[model samples]
Target: MSYVPYSVYQPLTKNEVTLLRKKQFEKWEHYFLNPIQIGQKHTEFTEVRDVILQSWNRSKEYQDLNPMIEGSVKNISDEELKEIRKKNEVFHLAEPVLKQAGQELSDENHVLLFCDSDGIIIDNYGNHSVSRNIGNSVNANNGAQWSERWAGTNAIGTSIILKQPIQIFSSEHFSYNCHEWVCSSAPILDPLTNELLGVINLSTTANSFHYLSMMKTIGLVNQIERILFHNYYQVREMMQNIYIEAISKWKNQIVILCNSKGKILKINNDTQINEITSLMSVTVENNECTTKKEWEDEVTLHGSQYRAIHKKIFWYDRFIGFISILEKKSRLSHSTTIHNHFAKYSFQSLIGNSEEFKRTIHLAQVAASSDSNVLITGDSGTGKELVANAIHQASNRFDHPFIALNCAAIPKDLLPSELFGYVAGAFTGANPKGSIGKFELANKGTLFLDELGDMPLELQVQLLRVIQEQEIIRIGDKIRTPIDVRVIAATNKNLVEEIQMGKFRKDLYYRLNVIQIELPSLRRRSEDIPLLAEYFVQKLSVKKHHGPHHITAEAMGILKNYSWPGNIRELENVVEYAVNFSANGIITPESLPMHFHNQQTLPINSVSINPVKQAELDWIIQALKRSQMNVTDAAKELKMSRSTLYRKLKKMGYDMKSLK
Candidate 1:
């Protein structure tokens, strides 16, 4: 009587039962044929003579079926052996993601197979019955040689080979054994380039497989792609936003907006009235006057006291808005000095000229000149690392390596291994050889630790010891390594405050603060506006391989009066923006960004309101009209404190007496 393979189980699909039966038959055929080959080899070749001759009686059926095979058996050539090894190589790639997914698949009566590009099983998980039936280990340690050609064309190998998703079921499999298994596979793509990253598959015995399993795997792959896509986008966007905010926070008085239409849409704290009016006038011109849309130069309507520049903003596929640059009338001379100072540090490659920045760079250079540990404090996007790099390059150590690392970029658990070398076999799956940390790599050079505030306190202590002793002991080693290295640490957060909160070590703070450089926010420095614009315009033109470019005098003026919250980085960005958007030969107030336009709506078209100066004018005019041009009495009623009121009237360029 036929013996049951193992035990009774539930009924299975026709494909599933057929696959098991076919594989069983192939196994029986192999067993029955093996003894005959052994008998022939023993008769001619001496390698397995004793065992082969002993088993010859069991192979009578094989001898009757063949004639030439009865003489001798031949050895496989090196080339033939090489082909077997090559097939094994393809299965190794799927070992990791498969191992991680093993437990989950085993419980579900499912086997996850990592196949080579050829659909040969490289690895798998599940019970012996399933594993054997699936035929995963026949070729390698995985013991399976099932290929789409032998099993059937399927999602696992087909998707990876084609670099696209595919599905194949029992009937679709090329081989009867694979017909019992159903598979769903998708191409894992690199988030950035949309290239095939790898292939992911979910499979089960035909009896256990369901359509839902296929759907679930596809959903998982999609989620991974979405996550990768979002992360890439956020990284870029965060950098830009941080730059803008850093400048804006410091330059509180200037409001810079990038809006549609090459119009100045807003202004910051500027005292000049006539200049504000002219800028407002330009905004009106951009909106109402079509007039061929040619860019206009710096226009002096009321006076030559103020200047403005216009630049357009473009992102992705469309032109988003314009950036209106505004600046003050006074401080032009000192502004020129600041501008030149900025030029010295300013990159024809970078844009930004601000007083605060000039001082910050000067301090950074000084810090760099010495080996003293420096603490660079500033808001995000204020170019803390840029400043650090500048210091490194300016110092005597410029010839040596200047390595910068973000202390907070790595996870806390891995920070130790990342910062200090780890001995070989320190942990499972670790490099067989020791791995050197960044600190060791930066030996005899400058190590710029960015985002130092984010380092965990535990790692901080270890780092502090390294800095103090000028040595490090690798994980899993007793030997101490002494090295000479200079450290430059920068952070956007206030470490002093962090210290008070018990988050940072005071000792480490002192070590890092040996020389401290606090960068000023962009808004504080109003004097360096013009040179910055010119620098950005020229730099961007060169980078774009475009115009011999210019930002008109008016544009320069607008830049000065406006607040810059994003600092030098923002200034550089705006310049790059203007340079990039320039279709005309020059960057005019109209070509400028709309956010730079310091204009607003009014009830009447004729009523030109310079908000900063207009408020004062309105007050003065009302006081004069009420007092019948009596200055002494009008000052009292207006509560102007006399001299102050007189000064205000003079500044407003209005005579109450004339109104009377």
Candidate 2:
């Protein structure tokens, strides 16, 4: 009989078919004497053996081409095994198989085998009777070595070794003692790539294996394979549908699906039909319009300024169809409340209310009133972004989009495409459907570029061009699309210094610095601590879902004295820590962080201005002065320990050398 290829739709390589056959025959020959083995007659086993051996030989010749390690033994770690189970989801998918197999194989005589990636039997059928024999042997879970070489030939290992199917009878089993049952196994192929997913086997205490039993096992394997294949295909289809929907909804683009012959299968009518109808009327009325080839973006919509960009679609490198998207020069005007544009976010959402904060907000509002580019300068964590957001809200474009992007967050190589948008498939891993960048999204609105100092020099030049020309050409495309986005840039580094260091473009800085807002650190606004602390307590309580917000006067005093290096962010953290850990209704000095509470020695908090303390200090100073500023003598006169007096003086910012 002529042998058919293993997989009908997508045939496996001859080498693969050979290997699978060889493994099947080897296991078949070794298990022939066993009652469980399927092929009983010597003649039948011999033919099966020859066929498998020939397949295996041919499979080995192409061993180098196999992506999987052939015949390699792996000591699977627990974590690795768990990962494999997660990827395979065998337990999840095996329920239906078990149900079907249970009906076919009698409950009293059946064994369902679960193996590791290497086919080492880790579990068996839930039945106690069939499981008893599998528990204590070297071939069982604890002692089993899942390799064809270790067992000299077995269904599980050889099926995996050759990536094929096999059945071993009771006596044909290589192990000397265990030949009471037959085992049938098949390689579970991955639905997507048709790789060897794993092996599924059924063992039972039955007579010599028959074609009927082997066929049942193969049927179970196919069922499981179908489930896996369907899952992958369904997930991919769902994701594609989601992408198509998102593009239509958010971007208002059109999507067309067509057959290879270019007949339209589907058309997502995301664009305005009235506009398309007008275009058709114009083409029909003007005979000149029918014969002339027009650039996609140049194709006016029914004599309207709006144009359509034509893009092709492909799936698996097959041309699906073409899509025409009507491109509007500006965003649609909406009749919603202007406040709703920033309903979820606003200047009030900013974390602080310090004098410095008020000053920053005022300047931001001033900058926003004008269309001039605004540059915000500050140290890291000084609320530069808050200022930017505030400015966006204050601008004439407040009702329009307000998009923020961190220049430093994007990789240098991809920053250009990330900022300026890109043509579809401009480079490897580029979005096939293309994407609109933040700048385009912010057209007729404000673009807040955070950490602008970190932008690459090449991208800086491109950005400058956009700012000056009021247009952008996507990467890999030359059509200059007009844009109208107000640029609001912020940086922690000084652009002058950056320019001197050759890290920032001086010309770009000049353009961006048309209006500037500088944010001051929290330490400079220590006077606002009491009010800010109260605000923080309320905000933190609400955010943390805690109740009965209160802060002791002592804690507020401690907060006011600390020089916050991390600025408002650090202050928020301290308040949050107090709110989370403090059990009392009021957060006290004791409730403050250990570092802040113990920093009583810091001069900012010490009572250095008191006259009594000063008199005592002065008397001690006089005594030390008379004793040639000897701290020991001074301590004796003050009747305190030398260390105590020294600490007091240091806390008071009194230099011992100056006292001497």
Candidate 3:
């Protein structure tokens, strides 16, 4: 089954649906309460899951009334404990996946529980603060035996027994102590064999039932299984490749070849290779091939037993024929052959001379010089991403990958796998061989996390942890892979305001804001408009294969004076539009978008761009209002003495007091 993302679960789940469900829960509760008076025969609760009914029956059979919060467990010998742990080694793969998921539901007063195949909790945590409040009823701490017999029909125990995913809420939990909590659980299984391994359970307060709880738990279970499957496939592929390479190297010496099924597919140089019909036949017809020197075997065919060495592989845990290693041997390995992604922009490419713009670029360069996390903030089209690319290109990590992902573009459920990656069989619908995540791809380089304010708070916690530890655990994999990635996060939204609104995490904000670079909006740096537009025009000419073009003074005035709400990005689009509309290499007012001439929101219904004259003229008018015609106070407000303000205005041919 596919996962139900929060978008569908949280919003579409209405108050009416919850109220309807509460009514149904009351029906099941009534039936369970009147067990002695009610007959089991022909008695059924409509809309109630059979599994839940079975759990209730099991609890009734055991005469377990008012079951305690914590279940009793028999002490095992060290050897037994070790064997149990070893058998449950696969359970560790679910730790990170569950940890991230638990934190996702932390605000909902939830906790995550992981149990071995026997339903004994090996690990448990979530919102520890909420967990503490639930007291003994909730805290199913490590080593708690929660099998159906011990825990008495709980989600974890019931899941293990049923070998399927299940959800139990409040009074539905067969035990009285667990009535305050809602638990949704999915069984973890062997990726290759689908054998029941354990269960991944999410426990939350019944009063605070989250709509996505069951869906998320099931999704996580699928993810963990996919990881196991992925890892197993990788191992088989790796061994097959190694075996094929070894045999090919000794092809001339032993003149032998075999296919994946151990049958002699081909042979060379009249060597008696066909005598070994199959790997197992070789082992059977000859002496038992032990003391396993890889690819070496004693085989007998045609009644002649000879010591033959050919690559042999394994399937499951059984030794089998050599699997095909079809890939050609290459001089370049993954590390060297892997493509190094390039950043499109460098500091020199940031075309702006405005003081505010220049200061931002300089700060970006400084941020690049040091390997600190950077937060680039500005309006959507104000070149925050370009600044990020420039910083990456300028940094020591330039030679490595410059991975970029827009947080807003990816779905919330898929973000975890895309960021950290997963092992094969980590979940259903996952690749059989697994896939690499951005964190791994950006190792030793820079990862540009754009639209970071849009990142869900659940993921922010994990992101903060990765930043602090400089490490990540793949989904359904226990190994902690270290990464040296410089994070450059960009956002159009104000992160400080987001943190105040509780949409962003304070700790993560501080971590990512180590080197903050706030780019100026295009409106704030109006003088740079011409320079930026000209650059875009020139750049677009070559791309569009249009002739070199010059914008007329009238068109430039419109471009400069009209306030650019969409910033540099919008300006670039406008330039492209103008180039296509322009003819004879000259762009006039006719080439500008219709809105410029529409004058609906134009400042003063006229378009004029004169940097020095316009600035002095505006100041003369503004200073007059602030000073009420007093030149001295106006000069002070301008941070200049009275004579300097008057002289500066007069140099540009402005009569300051008379104009005021």
The candidate that wins on TM-score is 3
TM-score per model over all chains = 0.39, 0.42, 0.43
Expressed as tens digits, the lDDT of each residue in 1-660 for candidate 1 is 111122112345667656754654443334344544433443322322232222222324333323112111222345544554354322232344356566656667666555444444445564545665554422222423323323223455456545665555443332334445566777767677676654556766666755566565666567656755664454344333423432443242233443343334344544555565556555745654433222334545345544444444333212334444444445334443311111012112223455457666667767867889999887666667777767766777665666778877878888888878799988887799989887777777778889999999988899999999999998888989998888989998989899999999999999889999887555444456686667556445333323346677887766665556577777787777666666545677666677878533112224455897787776665555334356665676566777877787666664445333
Off by over 4 Å in 3: 1-336, 600-660
Please give the distance, in angstroms, between residue 454's alpha carbon in candidate 2 and its true position after superposition: 1.4
Ranking by lDDT: 3, 2, 1
Write candidate 3's Cα lDDT for 1-660 as tens digits. 222211224533446445544664575567666554322543456444566666666766664443443533323455665666555546655667877877776666887777788887776677886666553644476666677776676788888877887777666666566766767888998877678988888877766777778887889888988877875665444454444444444332333344334455444334444443444454434433553424444444455444554434433223434422222123223334465466767887899888878888889889989999999998889988888889999999998989999999999999999999999999999998988899999999999999999999999999999999999999989999999999999999988899999999999999999999888777667779899988887665434322346799989988876557688899999998887888656799999888778754212213354787677667554544433456764665466787887786666565654453
Taken over the whole model, the C-alpha lDDT of each candidate is: 0.57, 0.62, 0.70
Mark the regions of model 2 whose C-alpha exceeds 4 Å error after superposition: 1-345, 349-357, 600-660
Q: How much is 487 displaced in model 1, in angstroms?
A: 0.8
TM-score of 3: 0.43
